[model samples]
Target: MDINDLRSAVTLVSLLLFAGIAAWAWRPRNQAAFEDAARLPFSDEQGGQS
Candidate 1:
């Protein structure tokens, strides 16, 4: 296996991984979970007593 072949394989694997993740993340069934994750930083877990 030449260096170029390894490079091409790595690129193809990376692209496939990116596409799979994008699909998983954007699918309708995952919308709620993603939305909840998106709100984690603003959740105010300390309560409203401030």
Candidate 2:
């Protein structure tokens, strides 16, 4: 119930949150969506018209 304990709890929560998001992003069901997002910057280009 001290400041250090609170800090440790916050750190643990943050780590768990990050891991969950990483797992979600790498799941097979999301591959296509992620790939499409990864290509978004180049999506506007067509037939080398730039």
Candidate 3:
């Protein structure tokens, strides 16, 4: 396809990818995991032996 067609396809794919990630991140099932990750910086390294 032409350059314009390729550009449009890439943009649409990127938008869909971003929307999917956003949905996944906001889903209720993942809330606890995301919250734990958000606390990584504040957690003590000794107790945080992953």
Candidate 4:
């Protein structure tokens, strides 16, 4: 394939990968996990524990 064809293939693959990740992140079952992650920065842990 030519350079143009290779570029198109890469773009299509990147788009598909992004869509798959978006779908996974938006699924209802993952809502709780995502929320917990969103709260991590505000948690009150003082320091890293052993």
Best model number under TM-score: 4
lDDT of 3 by residue, 1-50 (tens): 89999999999999999999999988999999999999988887786656
What tens-digit string does per-residue lDDT give for candidate 2 at 1-50? 99999999999999999999999998999999989999999877765753
Look at candidate 4 and tell me the lDDT of residue 7: 98
Q: Where in model 3 is the C-alpha error above 4 Å? A: 45-50
Query: Across residues 12-44, which tens digit of lDDT does each residue of candidate 1 receive?
Result: 999999999999988999999989999998898
- Candidate models: Cα lDDT each: 0.94, 0.93, 0.94, 0.95
**What's the TM for model 3?**
0.81
TM-scores of the candidates in the order shown: 0.80, 0.82, 0.81, 0.84
TM-score of 2: 0.82
User: Which residue ranges in model 1 land beyond 4 Å of their true spot?
Assistant: 45-50
Which is the better candidate, 1 or 4, if ranked by lDDT? 4
Which lDDT tens digits does candidate 4 get at residues 2-24? 99999999999999999999999
Q: Report the error of model 4 at residue 34, Å.
A: 0.5
Q: Residue 17 of model 2: what lDDT?
A: 100
Worst 10 residues of 1 by lDDT: 41-50
Give the Cα error of residue 12 in candidate 3, in Å: 0.5
